[model samples]
Target chain A: MIQAQSLTKRYGSKVAVDAIDFTIQPGTVTGLLGPNGAGKTTTMRMIVGLDRPDSGTVLVNGQRYQDLRAPLREVGVLLDAKAIHTGRSARNHLLAMAATHNIPTSRVDDVIELTGLTSVARKRVGGFSLGMGQRLGIAAALLGDPGILILDEPVNGLDPEGVLWVRKLMRHLAGEGRTVLLSSHLMSEMALTADHIIMLGRGRVIADAPVSEIIGQAGGATVRVRSPQATRLATLLAQAGVTVVNLEQDVLQISGITAAEIGDQAAAAGVALHELTSLTASLEDAYMSLTKNEVEYRTGGTGDDEFGDDDSDTTDAAADAAANDDPRETELQEAAR
Target chain B: MSTPTTLAAGTPETLADIGTEFVPASTPTGPHLNAIGIIRSEWIKLSTVRSTIWCFAVLLVVSMGLAAIMAFGLDLAGTDIATVPGTDQARFVAQASTFGVFFGQLIVAVLGVLVVTGEFTTGMIRSTLTAVPKRLPALWAKALVLFVTTFVAGLVSNIAAYAVTVAIANGQGLHASLFAPEVIFPVLGGALYLALVAVFALGIGTIVRSGAGSIAVALGVILLLPVVLQMIPATWATDVLPYLISSAGVSMFGLIQFAQVPLDWTVDLIIVLVWVIVSLGSAAVLLKRRDA
Candidate 1:
């Protein structure tokens, strides 16, 4: 288990991590989801004692990382894939780390083969590709068989096969009753691998819930209705709890009511309904909405005329929906507490 | 496409039927890490790097090779020491046999700087610090390993150089005994000086995380400062000149002696040690307080 209490880090005047608190329990894979510069790496570093928090404490298995008698056996951390010495071979790098814990050489070779790095174990890390480097980092993290494993961007530069392997390995490790906390920007991967997700934006926890709950809470099903009397139908569907967006003169996007309800109302009102389609929000849409306002660096509007003004309107509607959603706002407040 | 049933039928379903023993039955419990384990880890790190091997090889060849060249080129029988009023017989032989110390110190110092700065350059320090999160043990272990390895290298090279130089000189009808204080002490001091130079460089490397920056600073203090001090045209500068790092290092090995020099060999050893402590102490403070 990993617990961080009010952990805060500052680099000069800029705050990198702002008094965030989280608890990661065993027997499940927890994904730390954030955009670039959202303090996921900084938080992981503090957990492993690489960077000291200005004020607050992070503990692994109820003990400070530095105070653990055998740190490697208790908490295994891979903060960066390129953190290994490039001049050393993969086997030598693992051996050196194992030496610090007095771990046997047999365990070193075991991790090497387990990670499928046995073919290039004797080659220098500098010559390895980015995917190979990540494999070495994972091998080193597994060298001690620690109860808690922390990895940052483990699948950053991997092929489909390697990505699948990591997904399976994380689930396997967590299934064996070990705590696994991994950080990633890949929403699709997280949706498949993560049992729970802790979302961060601007160095603060914006949402913390199970994968299914976060997807459900982002936005419910929406119905797209096309009719000659779209304006009348929109007026009829307008209520205190429902959101209605008029995309065109004959089209209406309605939320907080099902497609059956829309069809029933249209039939009762004698409105000529051309089509009614239901759309479910994906995890990508959920993440984009949650972090719409927290992005640090944004590109300027190019004003490309090829796409016309319709694209900008759709983006604005999505952002508005994310900001004004009531259930998500309440959940954000609760997570902050 | 091969079906799972067909593949299973062709192979035995036992654990040994697999081509490799990839997984262990259980996590192996090993001995907990202590200072000894850290030292052993440091030793492996020190020995595995190619740059470190190159540096030690250079130190050995230069120290031993230069002494032989100087001893072979000397024509002792062609000149009378008494005719040269200020020339001391013992000092000349000791200095001649250890002429390589001047060049050897720089190489060892660079090795010292690389010992720590290499990790910073490659971003390996993060991995190192995470493994030993207390942080001080890693520093202490690196220093201890560097000190011991360099000291042994220095001792072995100095002894070999002295023996070779004496043999070459004996062939030219000149003699020096290994038991002579002038001969043994200077040789011993030369090794001690090289070891201390390496430790001093390690400290500077820790303070300056960049390899080039630390090397420049170490070389400046050991080589350039003495030359700059002489041109200052002040009595105080001249008085303080003997206490400089290079001067003290030279005197500690009994290679140079002057009446105006404030420190004798014994005091000079302490002064050089003080330099090591100050450099490493500040490095330890900054390392512990700074984010990796």
Candidate 2:
């Protein structure tokens, strides 16, 4: 188990990780979800004692990482794929790390095989592909068979098969009552693999809940309605919490209400509906909406020009909702991948 | 380790079938991090890298090659072999045997800097620091391993150089026994100085995390500082010349004397050690406080 209390870190004038508190429980895969600069890497570094926090403390297994008798046996951290020395072979790198904790050579070979790195283990890490580098890193982390595993972007450069292997490996480790914490910006991957998620926005915990709850909390499902009298139907569906967006002359995207309620209201109001559908919100949409305000480097496109003309405070919310379809957010996530 | 029966039954079966194949990790049964394991880890790290091998190879070759050249190129003209006294003859042979240490120090200095800075440049220090999060043990281990290995390498090269020098000097009718105190002391002292130079470089490497930058600084202190001080032509510069690391280090091995009043070899050794202590102490302080 890892517990952080008011942990904060700053680099010069900029705050890298603001005061944050979290407890990662054992026996589950907890995903750290955030944008690129949301302090995910910094937080992980502090947990492993690679970076010292400006204030407060982070405890791994009820003790500071520096104070642990055998840190490698208590916490296994894969900070990055390139953490291993490039001059050394993959096997030699693992062997040197194993020597630190007095871990056996058999365990080293076991991790090498476990990570599917037996073929390339004898080769220098400098020549390995990015996928192979990731495998070597995972192999190092698993060398001591630690109870807590912290992997930062473990599947960043892996192929689909490797990605599947990591997901399964995480689940398998967590099944044995180990604490598995992995960080990624890929909400879809986290949705499939994580039992719980701690979402960060500009170094602050924006959402902390189970995966299903996080998905359900993205304002629930949205309803799409196509009618001859789209404007009239939009007015009929309007309420205190309802949000209606006009997609075209005949289509309306309505949220904060159900399709059944919209269809019943439209039929009662003599507004003939051509089509009505309930669109469940995916984890991707939830991530975008949650991090829209927290993106460090916002991608520029048509949204800026649209938001420029409407400088009024009242139109800001409506303009932002329209800018959601700008596609730049998807591009940013793709760029991160 | 518990069985994964429920884990296999719960998740959907995929083509990889990775869930069933996964074996849970057991608790680590081995002894925790200790001094011996850390030192062994550092030895493995030092020996596995190509740069270390290349540096040590260059050191040995240059030492023997320079000794042979010095012995062969000596002009013993106009003086009969019987005219020179035994102590003077032994001193000449000892000087010839240890002449290569003047250059060997530079090679080992580079190796020392590379040993630590390589980890920083390649991001391997993060892995090392995470493994030994107490931080100081890793530094001490690296220093101890570098010291011992360089010492052994230096001793072997010095002994070989002595043999080469003696082989050629004997042909020129000048003889010096390897076991004599005048000859053997300098040879052993030269090797000790080389080992100390490497450790001194290790301390500098820790202070400057970059490979190129640390090497430049280490070489500058060992090779350039004495020359720059000599060029100053000042009383203070002359007075401070003997205390410089390179001057005192070379003198400690009876290879050269920079001071007008030659210091005892023991005093020179102490002066060289003071430099090492200062460098390593500062390195320890910065290493313990800084983020990895």
Best-matching candidate per DockQ: 2
> B1-292 in candidate 2: lDDT tens per residue?
1221222233464312332233233333566888899999999999999999999899889888999999999787878988999999899888888888899999999999999999999999999999999889999999989988998898888888889998998897888898888889988888899888999999999999999999999999999999999999899999999999899989987888999999998899998899898888888998888988
**Candidate 1's residue-wise lDDT over B1-292, tens digit each?**
1121212233354322221232222232556668988899889888888888899888888877888888878865667644643324455567766677788789999999999998999888998998899999999999999989988888787777877787776675556676577777888888888888898999999999999999999999988988898889998888877777678888777666422845778888887888889999988998898899
**Model 1 TM-score, all chains together:** 0.82
Question: Model 2 Cα displacement at B202 (Å)?
Answer: 0.7
Best candidate according to TM-score: 2
Q: For residue B88, give model 2's deviation from the true position in Å.
A: 2.1
The CAPRI class of candidate 2 is acceptable
Off by over 4 Å in 1: A220-280, A296-320, A323-337, B1-30, B77-93
Per-residue CA lDDT of model 2 for A1-337, tens digit only, reads 7778899999898777888888776778999988887899999999999999999888876578888888888788898999988999999999999999889999999999999998988898999999999999898888878888999999989999999999999999999888899997667788888998887766777777778777775656788888888887777776677777777778877788889998888778899999999987777776776666555234554566454333233223322553466464344323222
RMSD values for the candidates in order, in angstroms, are 11.1, 8.4
lDDT of 2 at A114: 94
* Best of the candidates, lDDT: 2
DockQ of structure 2: 0.36
Worst lDDT 10-window in candidate 2 chain B: B1-10
